[model samples]
Target: MISNGVSGNKYMDGPDQVVPSDTYISCVPGGHVKLRQTSRGLASEPPISVPGLLKRTAARYPDGPALVTKKADGKWHYTTYKQYQERVRTVAKGFLKLGLERYHSVCILGFNSEEWYLADLGVIHAGGYAAGIYTTNSAEACYHCLESSRANICAVQDKKQLEKILSVRSRLKHLKAIVQWEEPVDTSVPGVYSWAQLMEMGAAEPDTQLDDILKSISVNECCTLVYTSGTVGPPKAVMLSHDNLTWDAFVIGEQVGDVKPTVDKIITFLPLSHVAAQVVDIYTTLSNAVAVYFAKPDALKGSLVETLREVRPTRFLAVPRVWEKMYEKIMAVGAQNSGLKKNIALWAKDKGMKHHLARMNGQNGTTCGFKLARTLVFNKVHETLGLDKCSTFVTAAAPLSADIKKFFLSLDMPIMEAFGMSEASGAHTLSIYPRFRPESSGLILEGTETKFGGAVSPHGPGEIMMRGRHIFMGYLNDEAKTREAIDDEGWLHSGDVGRLDTNNLLYITGRIKELLITAGGENIAPVLIEQQVQAELIHIGYAVLIGDRRKFLSILITLKSKVNNDTGEPLDELDTETAKWVAGLGSKAKTVSEIVNTKDPAVHKAIEEAITRANKHAISNAQKIQKFAVLPKDFSNHTGELGPTLKIKRNVVYEKYKDIIEDLYKE
Candidate 1:
């Protein structure tokens, strides 16, 4: 506990327990591996309360650019730390005036924004629990949260969120009011007020009343109900305490380079509903005093390049989709360049790879060749991607390919892959310097105890079991399910199938519940196979491997492949075979839809060849995909085929294509 803030705790189920803070034995392939957390989350304990953390940061850097947002006309709006503090105070007062009692739940449904920030912190400051609903959730999903959390009030961002709330308004007997950042279109809804009106109403209320409530709040009290995305199943609400959040902020700071108040900057675009984004971008940023730029929801899709160029964040984190597009674009530009430029680029890429390897070997020195490559190659590469200032670029919420990780490291913009879930505030493990394992999810963080246990019968990796302060209290309002998650031994069953390497590095193999057992009695993890497809195949937006209790493995491939898997670049021109194939499909173009319904010769050859290549890595015939069917459209959040983080909604997709799935096994 000297530095890591984790006291010695035994991991075994027996009575005799004397395990140390930085020592735990993990199961590896053939022998036991030792794991430790030498570094601490914070050098010293952080502030106990979320509001107290904000106030201290404000006092230190009152004039610093705190909350930033770009306007409709393209001009940037800055909300200084001082202004941010004042607004949070005012909003807290408003909550008090509206009769929000201690531990009252308030739902904030929206994308990231300044108002959303105020509403979230204000609820905590006023001693209320804040729950966030994803902007991508349907009315039914939103309703479930509203009823489950028993939120007395809702602060929705726009009409879209409001419409969902209204859809189930009659069922929310506990909801007393609704406040909105955007102007309400319909004035007929009772107990609804515009943000301006709410603030004005609170302006007449006494500030001391809210102050007393904030001061009495304990660190162990529930602060937020962070719900899981439920990519493979129904969502569950995780109750994370104030201590849980404040500690994670410090852990994140220690893991990556710390978020500095006047120095660091980041533009947040991930859904506020997700634990990772909320903890890192909002709570962690506020606690560390980092500047946060809130990207407009509409502009999020198209303005990434422009925003990155303008903000040039010192610390950046994104989901896999963003990283994929950036990597593809850079690779494309390098391919399209002329003779001199292309030669220089390729030479630089080679040198950069060596530089990365050197770093991975724990050597800090850059060779003379790498220095020249940096001068000619990497510096420009960073600028083009608006990553010149980025010291840490993290990818989480979904598994990132090892190839993508290496590509950025070659550019000197290392992508730190991390793993976590809402059940545990934000992160449990991360790949960092000196201990970097691009293929694995890195070592366990301070205070977290994870061990593999209860593998599905005798085959495959065991399910991950974790017990730590980073873990949540329990599932909200569902005691039966809560007990099912965290056992009597205090371990929170992760339900993910994984293994710890001899070096303590964690590799997530699959979801225990999502495993597919074939007719041959061979157990297979679909996600692992899906990852292989993504890495090996061209134009694969998503891959759904289906072979549970079936004769052999077959897959559904959603294609919109941007580049050829072999070259990492777009086809110079369609090959004669593919062109002829397209001709047969009655389309004169090479596109996803054009090839989706046709037996286009080139498309067939490409997919078949890709499948054959993927099969080389398979351990058994049951693991290899024997056949695949193409989907016309890519999985999307709007269509409810994907979760907020872009993970496939397995049940929804299966239901949508029941007929197609039936036909696949017909022969």
Candidate 2:
């Protein structure tokens, strides 16, 4: 039996319980009901609740380090599994004492931290759904999520986050209390509590009510709400049951491998509000009793490397942008080298690339040159990046370009790619090493089922459909959309175009919704074309394709520029790497305005040449870019041109640049 490795508990390997999802979420008549009632994969990995997983880990490894954090003294500290469980219970009791009703949401808005995890599980333990709002969200966006989730209590990390809620507190009709988990809270405000105060309240309350609620926790009910990044429209709350989270965590951990009780370590730096981070940093670690180190609040702002160097985690997962940023920094540093040092670096990279390509092609790549390269350069690069201990390197959330993948491979780092949506609880296909081909999303998770629909050929590209226990319950409170998402047969329509090769490796082509149709009735996937443009011109931050029943495709390009860390807005100044690249191209332009206003000949010529090179790789003449315009500013979360996950918001871009697009299409 695929037990959670804990025995003797009556809940362990117990029969599944079907809870009323309508209380917390609304689904089609048989959406979640059918999955819960199905016995196909349920017997493989038994439906274990989140609370049960926590309890099992605590009991199985009482002394294991569950959570690690840095203190004021700059020393790493840890909370043992036993302590973590107790603290979760305390936080749960506190929520109960604060009048959190059953199925109500305890929405959390903050960076990943020990308190973040505590409050998350605590809310679920108190019989409430734990919803997370993106840290980059505006007060209005926060208000929408809070109101939609019907949150009873909202947790913020610092004063800034708390201020967002405070600005719209009166509008949140269902919100009863606010807890500032990091900074001090002004308790004078009614219903405002500090982290310490929340814990104290929980400690004072009897465990009778909390314990009773925990006993009634069913695996079939929604416990977490993953809000989509809302690239298309208003964010839809994807309701995930205990089974969805726990089963995914267990199966994903098993697939990635190397996860063990207390031995492995992983740094939590990605936004936990995203499903990928939630599964990898929180649930996956809990499932395997792996130690989780919390990155600093400024982890995204260059400090992530410092934390990584110190933590030296055993496994690492990063979004495509993060990996790309690292690549840029490495490239910048390598440019500073000269003479024999540069020669050695180049030689090592050549050897590394050859070795990686050979291995990827199913050959023994471990030759003398590879060994020498590892000793001379690759090993040092790994040590500096603190990935020396990392066995599994994963990239997800967005598509990674082939150029960036090969760049990392040349440094002896093979980054695996996983593909899925929030609707599937993080990942459906994971690319593990030896089987991980560039741009391929590897194989589907063992228990999950995937098929291509509407394809002309059996293995041809089509809409990717999946069905399994890992599928989410439904979009909360939208029966129509839920029914639209999950068909009568219970298969979730991904709306993503993909195909499975003979080797069963899934390759994602593009989003069916994001496709651009020409007036000539030709369909073009913008992402691949956009990626090519960006790959050819590393200085381009974003390339948005615009053509929907238009004559031909045109693109809006943005130069790589600085961004306001506080606001997530792109700044006018060019980023350092972009500046260097421009200087290398014989251009004196330093800012985006300089290049756009001056139309610097060197910069313009370089971009045109790059686009020409990219177009040559297009399958057809209709797919090539016919015109382009450079935007004054880069796309950013603040400007609403990009989503929280850094994926381009195509509609927002098109609307914002309508005038320029019209000008480009003019006869």
Most accurate candidate by lDDT: 2
TM-score of 2: 0.93
Superposing every Cα of model 1 onto the true structure, what RMSD results?
8.2
Per-candidate total of colliding backbone pairs: 1, 0
TM-score of every prediction relative to native: 0.87, 0.93
Candidate 2 off by > 4 Å: 1-43, 455-461
Which whole-number lDDT from 0 to 100 does residue 545 have in model 2? 86
What is the per-residue lDDT of model 2 for residues 250-332, given as tens digits with 9 covering 90 to 100? 88878887666799999998888999999888999999999999888777667889888898998999988889888877887
- Model 1: lDDT to the true structure: 0.74
Clashing pairs in 2: none
Residue range 1-667, candidate 1, lDDT tens digits? 1122332221321111122323221111001111222255442353366777788789988999889887778788899898998999898888877777666678999878988899999888887788999877778888888877777888998887888898899998888888878865455678777899778877778887876676466554567888887653577777776666877777777777545667798989888888999889887787777899876574335567777888888888899888987876676566569899888887888888887788778788875588898999888888877889988888899887787787777777778877888877888888776577677877677667887776342323587877665677666655566667766566677778888887677898888667888998887989777777777753566789988889999999875533344323333344343344445545566666556656556666777888898899898877999988877666666666777876677888888887778888997
In candidate 2, position 242 carries an lDDT of: 82
Top-TM-score candidate index: 2
